[model samples]
Target: ILGLLDDSPECRAFKQQLADLSLIYGKRGERGTLVTKTVNPAPLLETLQYYFRQPADFLEKQIHLWETERNERLQSVRKTLQDYPQDVVEKFERHLKMTENANQLRELNNEWLDVPIMNYFRRLVQEFARRLTESKVLEKTIDVYHLTADELQEATAMLPEVMEVRQRVHERQVEEEKFANVTPPAFMGAYPVDAVYTLDPLTLSYLNTEAPNPVDVPGGLGAVPASPGKVIGRAKVLRCTTAIN
Candidate 1:
């Protein structure tokens, strides 16, 4: 079960579990390596209380919808498999079941385990950052991200004069600013860019760097559709957070 982040005795125990779990679980986005943002205690507690008071049936409805969709998909698959050999059909059905189970497990882990653990870790780091800021060990709470876990711990325990740490953070921040303006090449090193698909089949599954089997149109490029329809509008393609802002 997922534990709520709060000051209650049960939540205090959950926080300890998070400290141990933090070594393995973390955000998987661009700032995955950095300490996550803190949850504001007042707002978080208020949100929890509000939800508890309102008792919605959203989960029950969602479960019903999921069951309906799964049944429809399974029926469709079995109908399609009728012409195939018994052994082949059995193998396909088994694979489908395994895939469904794996997907469900992944969802449960992400919602119940990964999110709560990471948020608790975020709360931990942000609390440490606030203390460091108060002691003048760090200029800003966000600067705590520039320090590694070990460095942060040392700073917190030993309370060293962090002029050097400040300098290091400044230099790294400068490098980040420099890279902000630079656009990276799609493919690098000895491998030819055009041959990326041929060289690595897994690249298609992972990276969205290249469009597969692009077709030539009158004035534009035609691409494979991942979804059903097309909506044309003014779209801004942003490479970084600065551009998004």
Candidate 2:
């Protein structure tokens, strides 16, 4: 059994700490998913236990390998940058420092702030959903998302009939599905003429602005790898959140 199956206090606390590990703390729409989406801890805990069984130095070795590769790339880039003027090198160094600092802050925020807060909120919602289901106020736990915060509060105070709440949820869900196939306009009531082109480099990158050009390859696809390694496993594509199952 995975360590997560243990009923010990330590194991329970460990699971609680990482309960939101898979939460998508990104923007709205398709990218927005909460810890509630993956309430079960078995999958994540099982994967971690499998890795924990590897050699004692397994993780350390991987980190060392990555550091070596990164240093090599840095030296190569520095050599190439030597051909540029001093001011250019200084500008590059400044940008590099800024990027490193930004990344550090992002990691700090995710680990200490975002993850804990989101998971705490998820637990609260789950507890409320459980109570709502027990009181026959909700058809299911996940249906809690159908009600706005104020509506949910009212539901708690004034125990409404299940049919009435369910009907309200159904209507809202139907309205949402109406826009499933619709593509939103690129700009909505824009004011400035230069607004489209005035975005900073970082903002444009975050928006995933188009590539400068496209390249054709012979019967193959390419992508920038998020990490260094290869693994053979069955791949599944999730087109929508509900498709996960």
Q: What's the TM for model 2?
A: 0.41
Q: After superposition, how far is residue 205 of candidate 2 from its true place, in Å?
A: 8.2
Pairs of residues at least 3 apart in sequence or in different chains that clash in candidate 2: none
Worst 10 residues of 2 by lDDT: 24-33
In model 1, the runs with Cα more than 4 Å from the true position are 1-82, 85-90, 96-103, 160-164, 189-245
Per-model tally of clashing residue pairs? 0, 0
Best by TM-score: 1
Q: Please give each candidate's TM-score.
A: 0.44, 0.41
Candidate 2, 1-245: lDDT as tens digits: 44634589887666556654535442112123443233455665678778989999999999999999989998998997887666656766887787777764354455445665676777788887898899898888988888888878778777554434888888888888898878999877876743223343454565568533223356855433222234444455666899986
- Candidate 2 residue 147 C-alpha distance from true site, Å: 0.5
lDDT (10s digit) by residue, model 1, range 1-245: 23454558888787666655554553332233433333324454567677676648866877899999989998988997777666656667676676567554354454445655676688889998998898888888998887889888888887655434778878888888899999999777776644433422233444436545644477865544332233444445666789976
Q: How high is the lDDT of residue 6 in model 1? A: 56
lDDT of 1 at 79: 95
